[model samples]
Target chain A: MTSDNTKPWLRAEIAQWLREGIISDEQAQRLLERYPSTPEPVEYGGGKGVFASLGVLVFGMGVMLLFAYNWAEMHRYAKLGSIFFGVALSHGLAALIKDPRVSSSLHLLGTMLFGAGIWLIAQVYHFSAHYPDGFLLWAMAALLMAWVLPSLSQCLLGCALLTLWSAVEVLEFNVLHFWALAVLLLLQLPWAYWQRSPLALTVVLMLLALALLVNSWHLQEGAALLHACLLAAMYLCAEHFSPRMSWSGCGSVFRRVGLPLWLALMLIFSFADAANIVVQLDGQTGAAAPLTWSMLFVLGAAWLWVLLDKSLRPRSPIQIAECALLLLPLLVLAAISGGVHKVGMIMTAANLSVLAYGVLFIVRGTSSLDRRQLVLGCGLIVLLVGLRFTDLFESLLARAGVFLLLGVLLFLAGLRYSRQKQRRLQEQRHV
Target chain B: MSRLRAILLLLAIAAQLGTLAYMVADKEAIIRHGHTVYLRTLPLDPRDPMRGDYVRLAYSLNQLYPSRLPGLQGLVPARRGEVVYALLRPVGDGVYELDGIADRAPESGVFLRGRVQAEAVAGEALRVNYGIEQLFVEQGQGIDIEQRQRGEAGFRRSMEVALAVDEQGRAIVTGYRWAPLAISVSPAPEIDGAAATPRLLVQLKNLADYPLAVVDNAEHCGVVLTVVNRLASSAAAPCGRYLVSREDIIELAPGAVHRFTIDLAHRRWFVDGGDGLQDVREFAPVSSLRLVYRSPAALQEASAEINLWRGELHSAPFSLRGFE
Candidate 1:
């Protein structure tokens, strides 16, 4: 077993060492008896079992479909009664689940069913025109459930519902909705922090990114550049303020949310179609540009906090450079949509930056000896290369050749890295 | 801490379930015990896009003139889309009419809280939907209901919908009844049209036991084009360019089939809604041709004054692509 393997078979290793005269019998016995003799009230399993929970989700959906199928035939009270019964019954089942994972699954099913039930009743009562209003009520109810149950699944469901609700609100109206969303979410942020849930905070930041996206959709042809800027700023503020915000408690959860988002934005902005959105000069898009000021103001506050606080310095050069790259376009567009002139150059710069960022990620990951980061970096580079080939060449032959060439290069690189890692491990073992 | 969480969970469940039950119970009570009101609805109403599985309904009296309301002076609507409680008083036999709007729910009379969708200050016609603007049917049923309703002729067939409304300003649609069709109109076969002029085939089947009589002496009963564009979103889209009104009286007997032909080639055509008469040979390819003919109540020709339940009849949408 390697030293860094998360769960080590230490007892067996110690026993073997003792047998081989590396340690005394007493030492082996002492080490073996190290576990606590006391029994715990709630015993948690090692990891979340994904499959069991998935089964329950499928079953719950099946049940919901069953109700909707018989909707017209069923009695009005029976249809309404069944929903309450399902919610209560599912929660009742959740109470019996001793396994943390299965319990969480029950809670999720209960939450999803609750949502379905609300929609069903809404249909039954003919509240069809004002559909978006239902989401607000549903999200609020989920928040209450999250508070009472306090699980990852419940919090996640609530976050998603609220995010969707806010997105719809923004699409309905631009700045007015954006302001309402900001206030609602910003208020929820402290509550999430008080819960010491980094997942919750990450959800908040994620929802903000989604809400910010409404600007691009509602404002322009498809202002991917603006969306990228807003998202980058949001990620930076969250990462920087993590310590003060109590996001320090649950480590790497923010990374789980932010990295994929950043990658998606990069991929989107890499395309020429997205660039057209920036270059196309439309009066409506120009007027809507001021709607992003509230987000930028929040980011500015975070930057100000970093500058004034002596204890909290900026993390590293890479982040600062990326922030600069993100903010550069915004700074250029500050006159609010005159990025039209700078569009072509901005497109080239964005494409180059994404490729360069991928390379940097590889170098940083290799130096730190983190395989996930290295693979992720390599995967991104390979993806970008594949994208370029597919975009440039319509013929399948040219694309396949490029794929084959990249595969050979990646295989050689991986072989070399493995050899180097092996040599390092040998050196450490000898020491 | 675990015990406390369990208790909290119990309280939360109770609260949610309690509220849900309360709402549902109120609605159910309306269905069980409330004054029943019926609306005579035509099938050609437009639908809202947001509502996927439902049909958006515009009632004939959805937009009401303020003068119709007995106490209309007090009901100045402040804003649009505001949920206003509508006070409906019984005007005739088993028919309750929308009397007025109020900010607060009325303690007496059949009341319904509806969001005011559109208001015409000058026209004084306020359009409101009491959450009953939609009829959510089981998936593809909306299309079917719409087709049958539109395909039917007015005098012989009709559609009626009933709803139950309580004093608490709640309303729920209770039942729907589509009129029966005896004489169905369809497009004439293209093979027959190739030889002569393009015409419609009106097939009248006596689905009932009573004898029926219609116009056999007149050369034509009604002339209308049923533009069959499957590419069209609505059944009534192309029909707007055609026409909807005209009455040709006919009499039929029990267990009989009456077939009438209307030329689609070149003919003098009068617009359904408008009185403008023009020579139209333009209706070449058609899907459905609606035939409107009145039937005598008794088997005699002079007994045209009496109109019974669904005395009017129209045909289903028949298929036709091109005509000579």
Candidate 2:
């Protein structure tokens, strides 16, 4: 109940005294009562929940196998009866169970059983329609379960199945599944938002990014540029939504995935041959279809909306840098599509952008004294130098010289870090 | 749980069960109200660890030559994965033949909707997959049924799958049976290999109108005999690549019977060892034996005038002691 900073220290001391036999159990208990333990935050029940979900998955597979055994001697009605009975039993058990872990596990099992039933029925009746339709149904059913039961397992399964469905549709049929994307955005996203599960949100965002990338794959030359735009849009969207999010640390998921990918794409573009290849392919393949233009328009609108919203706040240099990074890809894409074959000029600009971004990060990190950002900034420069050395210089002597320079710089950085740590320790001791 | 949640849970469970029920009812309705058509099936029995055994059914209608199809000769050829409809006209004997094909379904006729598995090109057979190309069977029964459907040398049996097609051009396999072919197998007199390793004669009669190219094993157009042990365990004889030249492929006329001699003891026989099935040089006396003939796959050679019989056939079980 005490708000004093030393309460934790005192509580730990009391526990240690109890353990060391200096204080009796009753006295320790009475003292501990004066400072009640802080309640643990809610989490997707850690290892136990994971194992239980896995157990349910395995059990679902077992049930599927048993049905797949295709007991030839059994009548068709018997098989159908068994499938229905199994689904009903699992759902019933899920409903009756009071324990959240057990109930969620049961619900997962029930959802999976229902999916297996769909396939099993197909097996029994020899129904072989579009296989993705089966997955679509399964995903819808799992999503319904997630909505009705309000469980993490159900939501995760729904997301996974929905992704699988979209992937199959795109890969197998070469068709962009707009309906799948619609379901994810309209149905799954709202559920995740309501549930307030960061994990689910992370999955939803990752899947959304993946689905967009896969769906836009047919744009061919436009795909890479579209990807950069999409990723930047995601990052900005995350920033825009962060203020509205009630939960702490939820917005970091988008940045965690998007920023690195954006940087990676920039690094890739910095290579001379990458931009050259894109330009060459664009020339041969010609301009993208009307659909790609419309999609780009939508994505551009979204990016603009988020960027406008972000601009209302006091802008950081890093935000300005990110905005520049997003614009650069669009400029390059437009140049390539406009019949510009100046690969060397574009590559130089890309390389300069990467160097500038790295320097900007280093400056920010130094000013903020943030180690992670500083390391990232240094790592980017190192990677750029290393990659440039690899392709630009064929001779061993030049390569060795580059390596020696890198090694010396790393040694100096390490030495500086050690000195800083020592100084911090001394200051702490003095205080 | 809240009352609203409880009701939702009940609805969810009902929907799950209803989905299963709908699948059953839909298939049943197709069987009841749909037009029944029989098509030939050449199935390969394969085992899946998860799904047990399934027979991969290849039908005669799977491959159609657009050049041969009068209706589709002038039309644009179907690309791979594009949906096409095949108009099935009842030929005779409860079987259907591919009479015509179209990009869209026929207004009023027995037709099947299938995806183009391969591109339709000139002088090449266009492959289509009807999605009814697999039949799940009991564990260990796929091979049995596949073998049984491929009758003995003299009594050739080919399987015909019965399909029920709804009005929407969707079809489901209702049933299948092993039908008869004109081919048969008979043993000839012992060759001059003396007493121990006696030679046996094997013959195949080509019944189809097209010229059949049969792969001659070791220059002998003979079938290998697989022995079934007392435990009902059977292993295939050790197979090796035979250098099949143009001369080695015996092209048979429509009514021609291909006869050749095979020395039974020359090839290694399979026996069940402690570590599963193993092939041995020694042949033990077995209760029953079956003839297995595997033909060469279709030749890519444009000069190939004969249709290569590109599948395996297993003869009905007969005792080697009878020949002895």
Candidate 3:
């Protein structure tokens, strides 16, 4: 039988790699022979995962809606029995079926049915209201199904519910809360990373970490600073993990959660009274954690150190300016502690840092001829300016002026982008 | 590895099914052969006994204070969620009183095993949860049970939990016994040279066929009766607020009455004799009294576990009434 080389793109990729001297000629030939040229088999795409998932979702929804309606007339045992049977039947089907899509979907459906049965039992035996024990049971059952089936979607479902379970746990605030979320994180983190789902990983990590931080640190303002720094460090790690670190690009991932938090803290602290309010709020819970400030400083400094020494070496003036962004918060904090009259100095420094970061991004994008970054960078400056205007001036006239300025700036940026795109298209034609 | 996984999967399924099977078996056994005892439950918003989707069954036996269990002297307080054994004494045909408490299992008689929940009602009462604290009913029946437990006119409805306690003191909440709860307040004549203010005697009778065991009952705090004026105002006088724990258990026998005395003798009323004002009892406003407390009652059920629900053996709520 001839070797199956149905996928010609593999050979094309090998050839390209060979041309680029990434692989030896002999290696390319070996790859080619390993996947030989053969006639393609005729096929129709059947039982696509999406369709199966969609069908199951629709069926599950129908079951939920049907059962949700006036089942009060039915025997409690009957309702419980049906839910139990559905879970057992779906799982039984999952074990029998070999088609991955069908099997995984069945597992997902079974997991959901199991959760429904848990609530059914609760309803049958009147459980407590506003209790989270049911959620814990539901999460465990879903996670168990996910583990047994090794289904990605089931794992995702488990993770999402687990997060909700943790959130519900906040009311009780048991010491066990931290451990449970952490355990779920350890269990699901691998699946998220293996799937290269950055968004999912980001969400899970953020949730688990935030829950742990809040419980351990008791939602103190200082904890927020540490939490932001810790997450930013993780995002930086994810960004630096590899070139193909994510299914989607990992550009400015740390900024997704961290930069906004930093900016928010800056904006909030930019007001003269916010710091004293935060201190008083901290007093209500208990003693403010003694090492909170130290933790914030250590984690923040570590992240800043990593960014400067390891990731970006500040070889150019623009890079050096970006590095200075890390130091600005510390300066702001120092100034605030000194007195309230010096608040404008910190605010001006903050505005300058934001302005510098924005301009640097815009210049970098303009130089590299990248459109998205240009829009984003210009957008940042406009947003910051608008925020500053609102914070500084309460009057409608100042607000109107801010809005007019933002509109003109955006219009100019858009015009410049269109012209740049045209010029780039002409350059490509000339090439 | 796949073989190991298969074994683990089987084990997990087995364990889950085992838990469910065990729960069913436990309840069925208690309902079939366990000894029956009655519990007196108070109306917790009888209009909607079923709060949301859950029927919250609060038994009189749920709370245990250190002072209540006198025999178990120096009984180490059980940590929250720790299981403690409580020995019981039959007060009458169907009701039981807490005799003693122990860390280990009880050998014989009507007793109960319960976990320690944090105290909810006034810091004095230690909350003990028998497995039968909550029962799950069908979706809409929660409201129905709640309403039935608290019939119209407020005090006419109450819930009686019949627990079947096995030899081991393990309990199953087999059923609920329903009855009416009523209160009547009357004046008690003052003795010669008795302090000017007379004592108001509020009598509450067990209208149910079974007896009821109550805890920390002296000064009639177990059955709280509040006095209100014509202004529709409920005032907290020293008489009503006075709570002295003289004894732990008070048994209201079947067809028997339990009397509570509200002291109005020591009231610091004011008197103005057209000159300067002096303290007098004449203006004190307590006229008619409304019984305000949820009477706690006890029965035992048979279940080795804690906080489970089984409603098959339940009876109509036990009734209480007061007469002039």
Candidate 4:
């Protein structure tokens, strides 16, 4: 008898063989029985989950606002006791409820109440704490609740709270809080992996990028170049690790988020003012902070590792362009450190790189028949041309001629692409 | 959930509750056992949307002039946002003044732990922030207290904050009281010098029955004078930063008056301009003048034996017709 793990195609071929008289009917039947069709999966509670989550969100927000009302007339202890009671009661209800969605929602409500309790306690005592400390404690509570309840919503609340903590510190106090970043990497990253949540991981990636900027904000002069390199590195790292990731579509998601970020950074770098900051004019040369050098080195090493990947050789023009794009900032960085201060040359190089990447994307999209890539490519090119036309060129006649040429070229490309697509379809139908 | 998981969940909840309970207990303990002290302060109406309306409590202990302490001249400077310990010595019943500031916790003394909001060079003024700086009142009640603190007529000095400072130097605001102080401006009868500017003799009086201290330093000065022109435009003397010494503070007995002169023709008078402050070289005739005094200095300078009065006041508008 064939195993149950037998491929569907093998069973199909066997049935066909029996019909063609290549096998006896009994043999085909016996083989087919071993590979019995698995039952279709039953999806449960889709609408229920959505409604439950929404209810949780609304209920949480209401509870927070109610708490903020600061029941001033009530006895302080009574207020504190009521908040404590609400948190425990919601959490207890969550424990009793057997439905997963309802239980998760209840847990979320409990966590939100718990946060309110912290602030309520603060209000009751008229506590004038270092304000960020409140957020840190709130984040800790949410994270701990997330861990205990194993709830995704709670995890998200924790992430948001932690980000708020870091933001308040960096923006209000102008202090770079490393502990928040450390917690994100060490605690939240693992939680994302544990939950196998691609969305959570993406949020973690974006937050990490923000945290990196905040942490290295002291490196004012060298910040842009260092950030550009880091952004490119993140993209490469995501691409390289996507396949090995446990969850499906993780790589695609990373690329979807990362590509635009990389493009935006590169676009900004293409401007002269931003580019010249890589080598300051006032004579303080090199990366201003040692951390900048350390980051550049780490990013360089990561790129090298990705480049030396034995399985995926850079054979395609698009892949080669990507590799070059990754190196462009570092090359500029090196030039700056080596006393090259030609601002015009750097600006030209940055602009040309953006133009080259735009063209590469268009070519790759056309060949691969990916509409999203094609749209992105066209958008990028249009943005570059639009920016240049808006500010760079002064001659209206030259601008008009360029626009006319661009329109004609785009029209011809679209026409050729449609013809090729039509021919391919016809050939497929004939075959 | 299994038994172990249930226990773990209980533990987590207990841990969170414990953390909150610890905060409550900590503050309660301070109120229970900490030394009670009165801080001089004035309030302005400000609201925190999340936490309701609060009267921003500007205390006299907020800024300490180390220049007053000749002994601290060579000590290491505390940078902004760095931990600072302000040693406070009681000058009267339930009133303490800053004795000295150290970067570290003092070995043994009654002190309030603070952060250096602004660092000053040696022998200059540095600002210290005790965390209990904000007094969160009931929603909308802040404006009432603020209004009382900035009185309607000629007086504004009123609010007195009570704080409990523990041995560890942490503090929590406990309560507030009202102590009114007054400022009066009148035309000066005498102009001695040939080139003397037209002057007004201003008086800062202790309207309350308690002895009070006034900041007479060149920096903040005891009182600020503003001249209102006929068009309702006003020009104010710019407050300067000068070394504050023991002599800078004048102790006023109950119902006592301290007098100062304001020169209307001084180059220092500036009016608000579109770009910035514009020099008020001249003024329109028949304009009225007003004097305002605000001090966020300690109510008592223990070393100087002066009980500093802290509050903001606006003098009743005085007519400048005779002088002009």
TM-score for each model: 0.68, 0.69, 0.66, 0.76
Number of the candidate with higher TM-score, 2 or 4:
4
Least accurate stretch of 10 residues (summed lDDT) in model 4 chain B? B228-237
Clashing pairs in 2: B153-B184, B153-B185, B154-B184, B154-B185
DockQ of each: 0.27, 0.41, 0.14, 0.39
Q: What is the lDDT ranking, best to worst?
A: 2, 4, 1, 3
Query: How far is each candidate from the true structure, as Cα RMSD in Å?
Result: 9.9, 14.6, 11.4, 9.2
Weakest lDDT window of 10 consecutive positions for candidate 3 chain A: A1-10
Best by DockQ: 2
- What is the clash count of model 4? 5
DockQ of 3: 0.14
Task: Return the TM-score for candidate 2, rounded to 2 decimals.
Answer: 0.69
Output the better candidate (3/4) by lDDT: 4
lDDT at position A186, candidate 3: 82
Residue A180 Cα positional deviation in candidate 3, in Å, after optimal superposition: 3.2
Q: What is the per-residue lDDT of model 2 for residues B228-287, given as tens digits with 9 covering 90 to 100?
A: 432222343344444456776777887677776655555343444334654333344546
Query: Candidate 4's residue-wise lDDT over B164-249, tens digit each?
Result: 88988999888877654666565676756443556766677787788887777543455555554221223334444323467777
Give lDDT tens digits, candidate 1, residues B64-141.
556545444456554566667777655322445556667788777777777766764863567777766667667667
Candidate 3 lDDT at A104 equals 80
Write the residue-wise lDDT of candidate 4 on A1-431 in tens digits. Answer: 10111244345457457657988988888877854644222222256665776687778767766766666687778877887788788878988899878888887787777777777766666676678888888888888877887766777778878888897787778776767778888998788778766567677767777766665564364574556456655655556554445553455545655766777777876777777775563323333445555666777676677678764345445567776875775566656655677776666666776777777666655554545665767778788889788668789998998788778756765665576556556544654
Top-down DockQ ranking: 2, 4, 1, 3
Is candidate 1 or 4 superior in DockQ?
4
The per-prediction tally of clashing pairs is: 18, 4, 32, 5
On the 0 to 100 scale, the lDDT of residue A183 in model 2 is 83
